[model samples]
Target: MNILILGSGGREHCLAWKLSQSKKINNIFAIPGNAGIAQIAECTALPINKDNFPSILEFIKNNNIDFTIVGPEAPLVEGITDYLEGNGHAVFGPSKDAAKIEGSKVFTKKFAVRNNIPGAKAYFFKKNDYEKAKEFIEGLDAASYPWVIKADGLASGKGVLICNSRHELLEALKDFFIENLFGKSGEEIIIEEFIEGFELSIMCICDGKRIIPMEPAQDYKRIFDNDKGKNTGGMGSFSPLPFVDNVLQKKILERIIFPTFESLKKEGIIYKGILYGGIIIKDNEPYLLEYNCRFGDPETQVVLPRLDNDLLELLVNAGTGNLGSTELAWSAKKCVCVVIASKGYPETFSKGDIIYGIKDYSNKSDTLVFHAGTSMDKGNIVTNGGRVLNIVSQDKTFNGAIEKNYNKIKNINFDGMQYRNDIARKVAEK
Candidate 1:
């Protein structure tokens, strides 16, 4: 079948790679795909947003595209799925209303409270209520020093900040309200009690009724190693969490996943596609951190490599609302993905620096390079965004996979290139 993918990032490239391997696929196309995706699929220069919906629809019809997979949350939140479905096109994503779970923090918080979903204690405030928010924070005990301040709307994963003192908290609030650092996304803010724990990523495929879980993955969000520095899209990720036993998994599915789906159902929203929970495991118990309406970025880079089933078929089933009792298969091997980003990422950084050593490992069986922010410049591939590329390796052991990634990364370089050195380090050591 002819398939079309939306967005221009590593996630889209990975999706194209997996689907291209499916024998059932006839032709693959991507809208605004990056350099690596262009090598395997037909890449077009169409933007994936509400303003280009008509043009996107025209392209789909002209190319007789049978299915479309959305890779980013922006278009989904802007109602692309609703529009495409309204036009009778099959799409693998949630409707705009369902996407509000990710688009609005206040909405998700209220939904969690109403459904008794376990999460951090949070207080919401509008931009005009800075004084009330300040008063609320000042009334809190000093023990809650490190509080999480979040923008209610999306800010490319940089909206959440951890304030360790009253001075820091007030500055963050000023950045949100007075400085307008996050634009309209910061119009509403959430001051949440910071839960101390390691974060986990759980993605489930839903068909408006039933849900099927994928293997759990752990991703590093901070820009530097050891989880320090400000957050970026993602720094690295690994799959098949060594610490998550069946019991903990069951609790997450029961307490967080089930209630989330059922609650959405009660609200008359039929969610079809990926329901990704950003969960925090504290004291062996799971707490909901946030939700991403689609697959996680670097998490997808690692998770998809371990999946043994035909991804195209699964997505088709989910999109068509016929995902009946489907159980996923997975490879026993471990997978690791490390992101190669431009220096000073998650902030202002230069672009168009020439990259090297990618083609040397292009044909390696154990390693795969998925491009995120790259473009063809006079026959040379150059950096085009902050998070540029993903180097993924799969092996029978975590140590083997982790070693393979680092070894290959040494040969790849560009001006102002930066990456975390400790991806999956603890697991490999163990």
Candidate 2:
């Protein structure tokens, strides 16, 4: 089958890596794909932006692209799925309207509140409504708790603000709204009461009716250990968290996952593709923090390696509206993925630094490297984005997997490459 995968990042790379293993796949094309994806599939520089929708559609029709998978939320938010399916094409992503669950934080928050879905209370505000913002923030400070300020629209993944004082929060608002740092994404904002707990990421596939949950994975987004520093795209991740036992998983499914799908269905939205529910387990309570329309970058890297089913068939089923009695299997091995990034990430960082050692590092040990934020400059792979490669390793034991990945990292090198070292240390400590 001819497949067109959209977006350029580690998540796309991981999907390409896993999907290429399926014999059902014949020809695969990645639009604006990174250098790493170039190894697994034919990488093309096809314009995937909304403005280039006609060209992309024409290419899709002409190439007989049997299926299309969108990797990032940008084009989805811009209605790429709606356009393609409207033209009678099969696209593997949510429609623009369905994507509102992830596109607008305020919208989803209101939905959760209306449905009585367990989550933190939030105060929404428009950019021009400074008085209300200040009033809400002051009330939060008087309550004496850290509140999370989130840009209601998509700002990549760095739009979330966890502030200790009202001053830092108000300053963040000035930078977000007045300075327009996040562009039109900051046009609206929501201040949520910060809930303290371990954050777990749960992704499920929906065929507009049936919801199939994948194995839970936890991703570390902070730049430092113990959840400190600014949130980057993602630092590292591991699959099959030990915290959520069978009972906890059942509760999450019954309370949050099942009700959420029902709510979206009630709204007449065909909730297909991936739905990421970021849940915080506070005092043993699992509360929905936010939703993402597509797969998480580093999280996908770890999760896909554990799948024992044909991913290509599963994705096609999701797009075609029939899951086809599919049941996913997994190995007992735990997978850990560590992201190797540029020195100054979630901020300004230089690119084009030549990465070395990967040439002799493929299929080595339990570690598999998927490239992100990289490009083939002539013949050498060089940095292209903040996080460059997701180095994944697996073992029967969780600690064993973490050990293998960090040890494998020593074999790969690039100038000014930065990576988090504290991944899975919590599990290791016990």
1-430, model 2: which lDDT tens digit per residue? Answer: 9899998998998898888888899988889899888887888797788999898898888888899999999899899999999999998889898899999999999999998899998888898898778777766645566888899899877788878887898888887778988888889988888898989998898778788999999999888777788878889999889878998898888889889999999978889999989999988879999999988888888888999988999998998898967888988889998888887787866688999878645544578888889998878999988889888988988789888888888888998898888887777636
All predictions: root-mean-square deviation over Cα? 1.3, 1.7
lDDT of 1 by residue, 1-430 (tens): 9999998999999999999888799999999998899888899998787999999999999999999999999999999999999999999999999999999999999899889999999899999998998898788788778999999998988899999988899899999999999999999999999998988999999989888889999998889899898878899999989889999999999999988999899999898889999999899999999999998999998999889889999999999998888889999999999999997787876689999988444533888899999988998898999999999999999999999999989999899999999999889846
Which candidate number maximizes TM-score? 1
Candidate 2 residue runs with Cα over 4 Å from true position = 141-143, 360-365
Q: All candidates' lDDT scores?
A: 0.92, 0.87
Clashes of each: 0, 0
Best by lDDT: 1
Question: Against the hidden reference, what TM-scores do the models get?
Answer: 0.97, 0.96
> Which stretch of 10 consecutive residues in model 1 shows the poorest summed lDDT?
357-366
